[model samples]
Target: MEFTETLLPGVGVRYDGQSRDGQPIAIVVAHDGDVEIVTYQRTDPDAVQYRLELAAHAALAVAELLGSPRVSARLVDLTREIPGLHTRRLVVAPGSRYAGRLLGDSKARTRTGCSIVAVVRGPDVIAAPAPDFTLLAGDTLIAIGSERGLEALAELLGLTPDDPVPVMTAPV
Candidate 1:
Protein backbone atom coordinates (compact mmCIF):
# COMPACT_ATOMS: atom_id res chain seq x y z
CA MET A 1 0.00 0.00 0.00
CA GLU A 2 1.22 3.49 -0.79
CA PHE A 3 1.00 6.12 1.92
CA THR A 4 0.97 9.86 1.45
CA GLU A 5 2.32 12.02 4.24
CA THR A 6 1.64 15.73 4.71
CA LEU A 7 3.20 18.11 7.19
CA LEU A 8 0.73 20.09 9.24
CA PRO A 9 3.11 22.98 10.09
CA GLY A 10 2.73 23.60 13.82
CA VAL A 11 0.66 20.46 14.13
CA GLY A 12 2.16 16.96 13.87
CA VAL A 13 1.50 15.22 10.54
CA ARG A 14 -1.13 13.46 8.51
CA TYR A 15 -0.78 10.12 6.76
CA ASP A 16 -3.33 8.93 4.24
CA GLY A 17 -3.64 5.63 2.45
CA GLN A 18 -6.16 3.31 0.88
CA SER A 19 -6.99 -0.14 2.17
CA ARG A 20 -6.61 -3.14 -0.08
CA ASP A 21 -10.37 -3.08 -0.53
CA GLY A 22 -10.15 0.54 -1.73
CA GLN A 23 -11.45 2.31 1.36
CA PRO A 24 -9.64 5.54 2.13
CA ILE A 25 -8.06 5.80 5.58
CA ALA A 26 -6.11 8.50 7.31
CA ILE A 27 -4.28 9.15 10.53
CA VAL A 28 -3.68 12.65 11.78
CA VAL A 29 -1.36 13.05 14.72
CA ALA A 30 -1.11 16.28 16.65
CA HIS A 31 2.00 17.84 18.13
CA ASP A 32 0.62 17.15 21.58
CA GLY A 33 0.48 13.39 20.95
CA ASP A 34 -3.18 13.06 20.07
CA VAL A 35 -3.99 10.71 17.19
CA GLU A 36 -7.06 10.90 15.01
CA ILE A 37 -7.95 8.05 12.68
CA VAL A 38 -10.39 8.76 9.86
CA THR A 39 -12.07 6.12 7.74
CA TYR A 40 -13.84 6.99 4.51
CA GLN A 41 -16.99 5.34 3.20
CA ARG A 42 -16.44 2.40 0.88
CA THR A 43 -19.13 3.51 -1.51
CA ASP A 44 -17.85 7.07 -1.64
CA PRO A 45 -14.16 7.29 -0.72
CA ASP A 46 -14.37 11.03 -0.14
CA ALA A 47 -17.05 10.71 2.50
CA VAL A 48 -15.93 10.33 6.10
CA GLN A 49 -17.52 7.21 7.59
CA TYR A 50 -16.00 7.32 11.06
CA ARG A 51 -13.28 8.85 13.15
CA LEU A 52 -11.54 7.43 16.18
CA GLU A 53 -9.20 9.48 18.27
CA LEU A 54 -6.60 7.94 20.59
CA ALA A 55 -3.82 8.99 22.88
CA ALA A 56 -0.22 8.52 21.86
CA HIS A 57 0.21 5.46 24.02
CA ALA A 58 -2.96 3.84 22.69
CA ALA A 59 -1.95 4.53 19.13
CA LEU A 60 1.43 2.93 19.73
CA ALA A 61 -0.24 -0.13 21.20
CA VAL A 62 -2.50 -0.44 18.19
CA ALA A 63 0.39 0.01 15.80
CA GLU A 64 2.40 -2.73 17.46
CA LEU A 65 -0.51 -5.12 17.39
CA LEU A 66 -0.97 -4.52 13.69
CA GLY A 67 2.70 -4.31 12.68
CA SER A 68 4.57 -7.09 14.50
CA PRO A 69 3.51 -9.89 12.17
CA ARG A 70 4.46 -7.87 9.12
CA VAL A 71 7.88 -7.13 10.61
CA SER A 72 8.48 -10.81 11.28
CA ALA A 73 7.42 -11.74 7.77
CA ARG A 74 9.76 -9.17 6.28
CA LEU A 75 12.61 -10.48 8.37
CA VAL A 76 11.95 -14.00 7.14
CA ASP A 77 11.86 -12.82 3.55
CA LEU A 78 15.17 -11.00 4.00
CA THR A 79 16.82 -14.11 5.37
CA ARG A 80 15.36 -16.29 2.62
CA GLU A 81 17.08 -14.18 -0.01
CA ILE A 82 20.42 -15.58 1.07
CA PRO A 83 21.09 -19.29 0.57
CA GLY A 84 21.21 -21.37 3.76
CA LEU A 85 19.97 -18.44 5.89
CA HIS A 86 16.95 -18.57 8.16
CA THR A 87 15.18 -16.44 10.73
CA ARG A 88 13.68 -17.63 14.02
CA ARG A 89 12.00 -16.07 17.02
CA LEU A 90 13.05 -17.71 20.25
CA VAL A 91 11.61 -16.81 23.62
CA VAL A 92 13.74 -16.84 26.75
CA ALA A 93 11.96 -19.25 29.03
CA PRO A 94 12.03 -18.83 32.80
CA GLY A 95 14.31 -21.78 33.30
CA SER A 96 16.59 -21.08 30.41
CA ARG A 97 20.32 -20.88 31.11
CA TYR A 98 20.70 -17.52 29.40
CA ALA A 99 17.58 -15.99 30.82
CA GLY A 100 19.35 -13.58 33.21
CA ARG A 101 22.60 -13.16 31.37
CA LEU A 102 23.92 -10.49 29.06
CA LEU A 103 23.90 -11.34 25.38
CA GLY A 104 27.63 -10.77 25.07
CA ASP A 105 28.26 -13.17 27.93
CA SER A 106 26.58 -15.97 26.01
CA LYS A 107 28.68 -15.36 22.88
CA ALA A 108 25.78 -16.76 20.91
CA ARG A 109 27.09 -15.61 17.55
CA THR A 110 30.52 -17.07 18.13
CA ARG A 111 29.24 -20.35 19.55
CA THR A 112 26.18 -20.93 17.38
CA GLY A 113 26.67 -18.81 14.29
CA CYS A 114 23.33 -17.09 14.99
CA SER A 115 23.13 -13.33 15.47
CA ILE A 116 20.35 -11.62 17.33
CA VAL A 117 18.79 -8.94 15.17
CA ALA A 118 16.12 -7.75 17.58
CA VAL A 119 14.69 -8.26 21.05
CA VAL A 120 10.99 -8.01 21.68
CA ARG A 121 10.21 -7.07 25.25
CA GLY A 122 6.62 -6.48 26.10
CA PRO A 123 5.42 -3.77 23.69
CA ASP A 124 8.87 -2.51 22.73
CA VAL A 125 11.03 -3.75 19.88
CA ILE A 126 14.78 -3.22 20.20
CA ALA A 127 16.25 -3.66 16.75
CA ALA A 128 19.94 -4.43 16.25
CA PRO A 129 20.52 -4.65 19.96
CA ALA A 130 24.00 -4.38 21.34
CA PRO A 131 25.88 -7.30 22.85
CA ASP A 132 25.48 -5.74 26.29
CA PHE A 133 21.71 -6.05 26.08
CA THR A 134 20.39 -8.28 28.83
CA LEU A 135 18.40 -11.37 28.00
CA LEU A 136 15.52 -11.57 30.42
CA ALA A 137 13.00 -14.33 30.77
CA GLY A 138 9.99 -13.85 28.46
CA ASP A 139 11.94 -11.76 25.98
CA THR A 140 11.50 -12.89 22.38
CA LEU A 141 14.70 -12.84 20.39
CA ILE A 142 14.74 -12.44 16.63
CA ALA A 143 17.75 -14.36 15.42
CA ILE A 144 19.08 -14.95 11.93
CA GLY A 145 21.39 -17.70 10.68
CA SER A 146 21.57 -21.02 8.89
CA GLU A 147 19.32 -23.90 9.93
CA ARG A 148 22.10 -25.66 11.81
CA GLY A 149 23.15 -22.40 13.39
CA LEU A 150 19.61 -21.70 14.57
CA GLU A 151 19.39 -25.18 16.10
CA ALA A 152 22.61 -24.57 17.96
CA LEU A 153 21.41 -21.19 19.15
CA ALA A 154 18.22 -22.76 20.42
CA GLU A 155 20.22 -25.27 22.40
CA LEU A 156 22.29 -22.48 23.91
CA LEU A 157 19.06 -20.78 24.93
CA GLY A 158 18.10 -23.97 26.86
CA LEU A 159 15.68 -25.32 24.31
CA THR A 160 15.99 -29.00 23.45
CA PRO A 161 15.89 -30.18 19.87
CA ASP A 162 12.46 -31.67 20.53
CA ASP A 163 11.06 -28.40 21.82
CA PRO A 164 8.93 -26.68 19.23
CA VAL A 165 9.97 -23.08 18.50
CA PRO A 166 6.96 -20.94 19.14
CA VAL A 167 5.88 -18.63 16.33
CA MET A 168 6.30 -14.90 16.98
CA THR A 169 3.06 -13.47 18.27
CA ALA A 170 1.89 -9.98 19.18
CA PRO A 171 2.84 -9.16 22.74
CA VAL A 172 0.05 -9.09 25.27
Candidate 2:
Protein backbone atom coordinates (compact mmCIF):
# COMPACT_ATOMS: atom_id res chain seq x y z
CA MET A 1 0.00 0.00 0.00
CA GLU A 2 1.09 3.57 -0.65
CA PHE A 3 1.14 6.09 2.19
CA THR A 4 1.41 9.87 2.31
CA GLU A 5 3.02 11.55 5.29
CA THR A 6 2.47 15.22 6.08
CA LEU A 7 4.01 17.43 8.72
CA LEU A 8 1.43 19.01 11.01
CA PRO A 9 3.70 21.92 11.96
CA GLY A 10 3.64 22.27 15.76
CA VAL A 11 1.02 19.55 16.15
CA GLY A 12 2.70 16.41 14.86
CA VAL A 13 2.72 14.16 11.74
CA ARG A 14 -0.17 12.69 9.84
CA TYR A 15 0.06 9.54 7.76
CA ASP A 16 -2.71 8.75 5.33
CA GLY A 17 -3.17 5.59 3.34
CA GLN A 18 -5.81 3.55 1.60
CA SER A 19 -6.61 0.08 2.82
CA ARG A 20 -6.72 -2.90 0.49
CA ASP A 21 -10.47 -2.53 0.33
CA GLY A 22 -9.98 1.10 -0.87
CA GLN A 23 -11.10 2.63 2.43
CA PRO A 24 -9.07 5.61 3.57
CA ILE A 25 -7.29 5.45 6.90
CA ALA A 26 -5.12 7.89 8.76
CA ILE A 27 -2.92 8.07 11.80
CA VAL A 28 -1.98 11.34 13.45
CA VAL A 29 0.70 11.27 16.08
CA ALA A 30 1.00 14.30 18.33
CA HIS A 31 4.17 15.74 19.79
CA ASP A 32 3.08 14.67 23.26
CA GLY A 33 3.10 10.93 22.37
CA ASP A 34 -0.63 10.79 21.80
CA VAL A 35 -1.97 9.05 18.69
CA GLU A 36 -5.16 9.36 16.68
CA ILE A 37 -6.45 6.64 14.37
CA VAL A 38 -9.00 7.83 11.82
CA THR A 39 -11.08 5.80 9.42
CA TYR A 40 -13.05 7.44 6.68
CA GLN A 41 -16.55 6.49 5.56
CA ARG A 42 -16.68 3.92 2.76
CA THR A 43 -19.21 5.97 0.83
CA ASP A 44 -17.30 9.23 1.21
CA PRO A 45 -13.57 9.14 1.70
CA ASP A 46 -13.45 12.62 3.15
CA ALA A 47 -16.06 11.87 5.81
CA VAL A 48 -14.80 10.48 9.07
CA GLN A 49 -16.60 7.35 10.20
CA TYR A 50 -14.61 6.50 13.28
CA ARG A 51 -11.73 7.83 15.33
CA LEU A 52 -9.63 6.34 18.11
CA GLU A 53 -7.27 8.31 20.30
CA LEU A 54 -4.63 6.49 22.28
CA ALA A 55 -1.65 7.22 24.44
CA ALA A 56 1.83 6.11 23.38
CA HIS A 57 1.80 2.96 25.48
CA ALA A 58 -1.60 1.86 24.23
CA ALA A 59 -0.60 2.51 20.64
CA LEU A 60 2.49 0.36 21.12
CA ALA A 61 0.43 -2.49 22.48
CA VAL A 62 -1.94 -2.27 19.55
CA ALA A 63 0.93 -2.21 17.10
CA GLU A 64 2.43 -5.36 18.59
CA LEU A 65 -0.85 -7.22 18.37
CA LEU A 66 -1.31 -6.26 14.72
CA GLY A 67 2.30 -6.39 13.53
CA SER A 68 3.35 -9.87 14.64
CA PRO A 69 0.92 -11.73 12.37
CA ARG A 70 2.08 -9.76 9.35
CA VAL A 71 5.69 -10.53 10.17
CA SER A 72 4.92 -14.24 10.45
CA ALA A 73 3.06 -14.22 7.14
CA ARG A 74 6.01 -12.59 5.42
CA LEU A 75 8.38 -15.22 6.78
CA VAL A 76 6.19 -18.00 5.40
CA ASP A 77 6.06 -16.27 2.02
CA LEU A 78 9.86 -16.00 1.92
CA THR A 79 10.30 -19.76 2.26
CA ARG A 80 7.80 -20.62 -0.45
CA GLU A 81 10.30 -20.08 -3.25
CA ILE A 82 12.47 -22.94 -2.06
CA PRO A 83 10.94 -26.37 -2.24
CA GLY A 84 11.02 -28.49 0.91
CA LEU A 85 12.09 -25.48 2.99
CA HIS A 86 10.23 -24.21 6.03
CA THR A 87 10.76 -21.30 8.39
CA ARG A 88 9.83 -21.20 12.05
CA ARG A 89 10.39 -18.84 14.93
CA LEU A 90 11.35 -20.80 18.03
CA VAL A 91 11.43 -19.18 21.42
CA VAL A 92 14.12 -19.81 24.00
CA ALA A 93 11.98 -20.63 26.98
CA PRO A 94 13.34 -20.32 30.45
CA GLY A 95 14.67 -23.64 31.86
CA SER A 96 15.66 -24.74 28.35
CA ARG A 97 19.20 -26.06 27.93
CA TYR A 98 20.29 -23.73 25.13
CA ALA A 99 19.89 -20.54 27.12
CA GLY A 100 23.10 -18.62 27.85
CA ARG A 101 24.97 -20.74 25.30
CA LEU A 102 26.71 -19.63 22.13
CA LEU A 103 25.15 -20.44 18.74
CA GLY A 104 28.30 -22.26 17.65
CA ASP A 105 28.08 -24.56 20.63
CA SER A 106 24.60 -25.70 19.72
CA LYS A 107 25.74 -27.18 16.39
CA ALA A 108 22.14 -26.97 15.23
CA ARG A 109 23.11 -26.56 11.61
CA THR A 110 25.62 -29.37 11.58
CA ARG A 111 23.31 -31.76 13.37
CA THR A 112 19.80 -30.83 12.26
CA GLY A 113 20.59 -29.11 8.94
CA CYS A 114 18.64 -26.06 10.08
CA SER A 115 20.09 -22.55 9.82
CA ILE A 116 19.58 -19.73 12.28
CA VAL A 117 18.98 -16.75 10.05
CA ALA A 118 18.28 -14.24 12.79
CA VAL A 119 17.66 -13.77 16.47
CA VAL A 120 14.93 -11.54 17.84
CA ARG A 121 15.59 -10.19 21.32
CA GLY A 122 12.82 -7.92 22.46
CA PRO A 123 12.80 -4.92 20.11
CA ASP A 124 16.12 -5.79 18.47
CA VAL A 125 16.43 -8.05 15.43
CA ILE A 126 19.88 -9.44 14.84
CA ALA A 127 19.86 -10.40 11.16
CA ALA A 128 22.25 -13.07 9.97
CA PRO A 129 23.46 -13.60 13.50
CA ALA A 130 26.99 -14.96 13.75
CA PRO A 131 28.00 -18.23 15.32
CA ASP A 132 29.21 -16.39 18.37
CA PHE A 133 25.77 -15.00 19.05
CA THR A 134 24.60 -15.94 22.52
CA LEU A 135 21.24 -17.53 23.14
CA LEU A 136 19.21 -16.19 26.02
CA ALA A 137 15.88 -16.79 27.65
CA GLY A 138 13.00 -15.04 25.84
CA ASP A 139 15.02 -14.81 22.62
CA THR A 140 13.26 -15.80 19.39
CA LEU A 141 15.34 -17.80 16.94
CA ILE A 142 14.39 -17.64 13.26
CA ALA A 143 15.32 -20.96 11.73
CA ILE A 144 15.01 -22.14 8.12
CA GLY A 145 15.24 -25.76 7.08
CA SER A 146 13.34 -28.81 5.94
CA GLU A 147 10.42 -30.09 7.99
CA ARG A 148 12.40 -32.90 9.54
CA GLY A 149 15.38 -30.65 10.07
CA LEU A 150 13.24 -28.14 11.92
CA GLU A 151 11.85 -30.86 14.15
CA ALA A 152 15.36 -32.02 14.92
CA LEU A 153 16.43 -28.49 15.72
CA ALA A 154 13.54 -28.22 18.19
CA GLU A 155 14.74 -31.41 19.84
CA LEU A 156 18.24 -29.97 20.08
CA LEU A 157 16.78 -26.88 21.76
CA GLY A 158 15.47 -29.09 24.59
CA LEU A 159 11.94 -29.44 23.28
CA THR A 160 10.10 -32.71 23.14
CA PRO A 161 8.89 -34.13 19.85
CA ASP A 162 5.32 -33.49 20.94
CA ASP A 163 5.96 -29.93 22.12
CA PRO A 164 4.10 -27.32 20.13
CA VAL A 165 6.33 -24.84 18.32
CA PRO A 166 6.19 -21.48 20.09
CA VAL A 167 6.15 -18.72 17.51
CA MET A 168 3.87 -16.34 15.70
CA THR A 169 0.57 -17.87 14.65
CA ALA A 170 0.70 -19.63 11.29
CA PRO A 171 -0.81 -17.81 8.35
CA VAL A 172 -4.35 -18.77 7.46
Candidate 3:
Protein backbone atom coordinates (compact mmCIF):
# COMPACT_ATOMS: atom_id res chain seq x y z
CA MET A 1 0.00 0.00 0.00
CA GLU A 2 1.16 3.55 -0.81
CA PHE A 3 0.28 6.81 0.93
CA THR A 4 0.28 10.03 -1.12
CA GLU A 5 0.45 12.41 1.77
CA THR A 6 2.65 15.46 1.21
CA LEU A 7 5.92 15.56 3.13
CA LEU A 8 5.09 17.77 6.06
CA PRO A 9 7.74 20.33 7.03
CA GLY A 10 8.99 18.29 10.00
CA VAL A 11 7.79 14.84 8.96
CA GLY A 12 10.71 13.16 7.33
CA VAL A 13 11.43 9.56 8.25
CA ARG A 14 10.34 7.92 11.48
CA TYR A 15 13.09 6.71 13.82
CA ASP A 16 11.36 5.31 16.88
CA GLY A 17 8.27 3.60 18.23
CA GLN A 18 5.11 5.03 19.82
CA SER A 19 4.15 8.53 20.82
CA ARG A 20 3.95 9.53 24.46
CA ASP A 21 0.30 8.47 24.70
CA GLY A 22 1.16 4.91 23.83
CA GLN A 23 -0.03 5.76 20.34
CA PRO A 24 2.01 4.18 17.57
CA ILE A 25 4.89 6.58 16.80
CA ALA A 26 8.05 5.48 14.98
CA ILE A 27 11.13 7.59 15.62
CA VAL A 28 14.83 7.67 14.57
CA VAL A 29 16.33 7.08 18.00
CA ALA A 30 19.91 7.23 16.61
CA HIS A 31 22.08 8.13 13.59
CA ASP A 32 25.52 7.02 14.75
CA GLY A 33 27.35 5.41 11.79
CA ASP A 34 24.39 4.52 9.63
CA VAL A 35 21.30 5.98 8.00
CA GLU A 36 17.96 4.52 9.04
CA ILE A 37 14.64 5.48 7.35
CA VAL A 38 11.44 3.79 8.39
CA THR A 39 8.26 3.58 6.30
CA TYR A 40 4.95 2.32 7.52
CA GLN A 41 1.56 2.25 5.81
CA ARG A 42 -0.62 4.73 7.66
CA THR A 43 -3.43 2.39 8.65
CA ASP A 44 -5.73 5.38 8.74
CA PRO A 45 -5.63 7.99 5.99
CA ASP A 46 -7.48 10.30 8.31
CA ALA A 47 -4.86 9.52 10.88
CA VAL A 48 -3.87 12.62 12.81
CA GLN A 49 -0.77 14.04 11.19
CA TYR A 50 0.38 15.41 14.51
CA ARG A 51 2.41 12.83 16.41
CA LEU A 52 4.85 13.67 19.16
CA GLU A 53 7.17 11.63 21.36
CA LEU A 54 6.93 14.41 23.86
CA ALA A 55 6.69 13.25 27.43
CA ALA A 56 4.07 15.93 28.07
CA HIS A 57 0.58 16.66 26.81
CA ALA A 58 1.17 20.36 26.10
CA ALA A 59 3.70 19.74 23.31
CA LEU A 60 1.43 17.15 21.77
CA ALA A 61 -1.10 19.91 21.15
CA VAL A 62 1.38 21.82 18.99
CA ALA A 63 2.44 18.65 17.18
CA GLU A 64 -1.11 18.23 15.95
CA LEU A 65 -0.86 21.46 13.95
CA LEU A 66 2.41 20.57 12.23
CA GLY A 67 1.23 17.14 11.06
CA SER A 68 4.77 16.01 11.88
CA PRO A 69 6.83 15.43 14.98
CA ARG A 70 9.07 18.18 16.30
CA VAL A 71 12.52 17.06 17.41
CA SER A 72 12.83 19.50 20.27
CA ALA A 73 10.10 17.61 22.04
CA ARG A 74 12.15 14.42 21.99
CA LEU A 75 15.43 16.06 23.01
CA VAL A 76 16.11 18.98 25.38
CA ASP A 77 14.09 17.29 28.08
CA LEU A 78 16.99 14.85 28.54
CA THR A 79 18.86 17.49 30.50
CA ARG A 80 15.98 18.13 32.87
CA GLU A 81 14.46 14.73 33.51
CA ILE A 82 17.32 12.35 32.80
CA PRO A 83 19.59 13.68 35.54
CA GLY A 84 23.19 12.73 34.62
CA LEU A 85 22.24 11.79 31.07
CA HIS A 86 24.52 12.85 28.25
CA THR A 87 23.85 13.74 24.63
CA ARG A 88 26.49 12.65 22.12
CA ARG A 89 27.02 14.53 18.86
CA LEU A 90 29.00 12.96 16.01
CA VAL A 91 30.13 15.11 13.11
CA VAL A 92 31.39 12.91 10.25
CA ALA A 93 33.62 14.53 7.67
CA PRO A 94 35.54 13.26 4.66
CA GLY A 95 38.36 11.85 6.74
CA SER A 96 36.22 10.47 9.53
CA ARG A 97 35.83 6.68 9.66
CA TYR A 98 32.02 6.64 9.66
CA ALA A 99 32.03 8.22 6.23
CA GLY A 100 30.24 5.30 4.58
CA ARG A 101 27.91 3.12 6.65
CA LEU A 102 24.56 3.11 8.42
CA LEU A 103 24.96 4.37 11.99
CA GLY A 104 21.65 4.55 13.77
CA ASP A 105 20.09 1.28 14.82
CA SER A 106 17.64 1.64 17.71
CA LYS A 107 18.35 -1.81 19.14
CA ALA A 108 22.10 -1.28 18.95
CA ARG A 109 22.40 2.33 20.07
CA THR A 110 19.62 2.23 22.61
CA ARG A 111 21.51 -0.52 24.37
CA THR A 112 23.51 2.34 25.82
CA GLY A 113 20.49 4.64 26.17
CA CYS A 114 21.74 6.70 23.24
CA SER A 115 19.30 7.68 20.54
CA ILE A 116 20.06 9.52 17.34
CA VAL A 117 17.71 12.46 17.13
CA ALA A 118 18.91 14.16 13.96
CA VAL A 119 21.14 13.58 10.97
CA VAL A 120 22.21 16.59 8.93
CA ARG A 121 23.32 15.24 5.56
CA GLY A 122 24.15 17.97 3.13
CA PRO A 123 21.08 20.21 2.70
CA ASP A 124 18.65 17.58 3.88
CA VAL A 125 17.86 16.72 7.49
CA ILE A 126 16.83 13.21 8.54
CA ALA A 127 14.83 12.92 11.75
CA ALA A 128 15.70 9.41 12.94
CA PRO A 129 17.34 6.20 11.91
CA ALA A 130 15.98 2.68 12.04
CA PRO A 131 18.12 -0.43 12.07
CA ASP A 132 20.04 -1.16 8.82
CA PHE A 133 20.70 2.54 8.26
CA THR A 134 24.17 3.45 6.99
CA LEU A 135 26.19 6.64 7.40
CA LEU A 136 28.03 8.39 4.61
CA ALA A 137 30.94 10.76 4.76
CA GLY A 138 30.11 14.35 5.72
CA ASP A 139 27.08 13.56 7.81
CA THR A 140 26.44 15.21 11.17
CA LEU A 141 24.81 13.07 13.81
CA ILE A 142 23.14 14.49 16.93
CA ALA A 143 22.78 11.64 19.38
CA ILE A 144 21.51 11.55 22.97
CA GLY A 145 22.69 9.01 25.53
CA SER A 146 25.01 8.56 28.50
CA GLU A 147 28.41 10.28 28.26
CA ARG A 148 30.43 7.07 28.49
CA GLY A 149 28.24 5.23 26.05
CA LEU A 150 28.43 8.03 23.53
CA GLU A 151 32.15 8.12 23.94
CA ALA A 152 32.37 4.50 22.91
CA LEU A 153 30.27 5.16 19.84
CA ALA A 154 32.62 7.96 18.88
CA GLU A 155 35.50 5.54 18.95
CA LEU A 156 33.68 2.85 16.98
CA LEU A 157 32.80 5.40 14.31
CA GLY A 158 36.38 6.65 14.23
CA LEU A 159 35.47 10.23 15.03
CA THR A 160 38.27 12.02 16.80
CA PRO A 161 37.99 14.57 19.58
CA ASP A 162 38.79 17.58 17.38
CA ASP A 163 37.28 17.05 13.95
CA PRO A 164 35.24 19.92 12.47
CA VAL A 165 31.63 19.36 11.47
CA PRO A 166 31.11 18.87 7.75
CA VAL A 167 27.91 20.91 7.77
CA MET A 168 29.52 24.15 9.02
CA THR A 169 32.32 24.08 6.48
CA ALA A 170 30.15 23.37 3.45
CA PRO A 171 29.84 26.61 1.46
CA VAL A 172 26.46 28.20 1.84
RMSD of 3: 15.2
The CA lDDT at 50 in model 1 is: 96
- Worst ten-residue run, lDDT, model 1? 163-172
Cα lDDT of model 3 by residue, 1-172, tens digit: 1122232344343334544454544443222212232334468733445533443344455455645444543565555477766665577766654566556422336444466777766556687765566777767677776677676656555654365432211111
Error of 2 at 19 (Å): 20
Q: What TM-score quantifies how close candidate 1 is to the native fold?
A: 0.54
**TM per candidate:** 0.54, 0.52, 0.43
| Best-performing candidate as measured by TM-score | 1
Candidate 1 per-residue lDDT over residues 26-58, each given as its tens digit: 989786667899998768877779999999778
Q: Highest lDDT among the candidates is held by which one?
A: 1
**Between 1 and 3, whose TM-score is larger?**
1
In order, the Cα lDDT scores of the candidates are: 0.78, 0.76, 0.52
Query: Of the pair 1 and 3, which is ahead by lDDT?
Result: 1
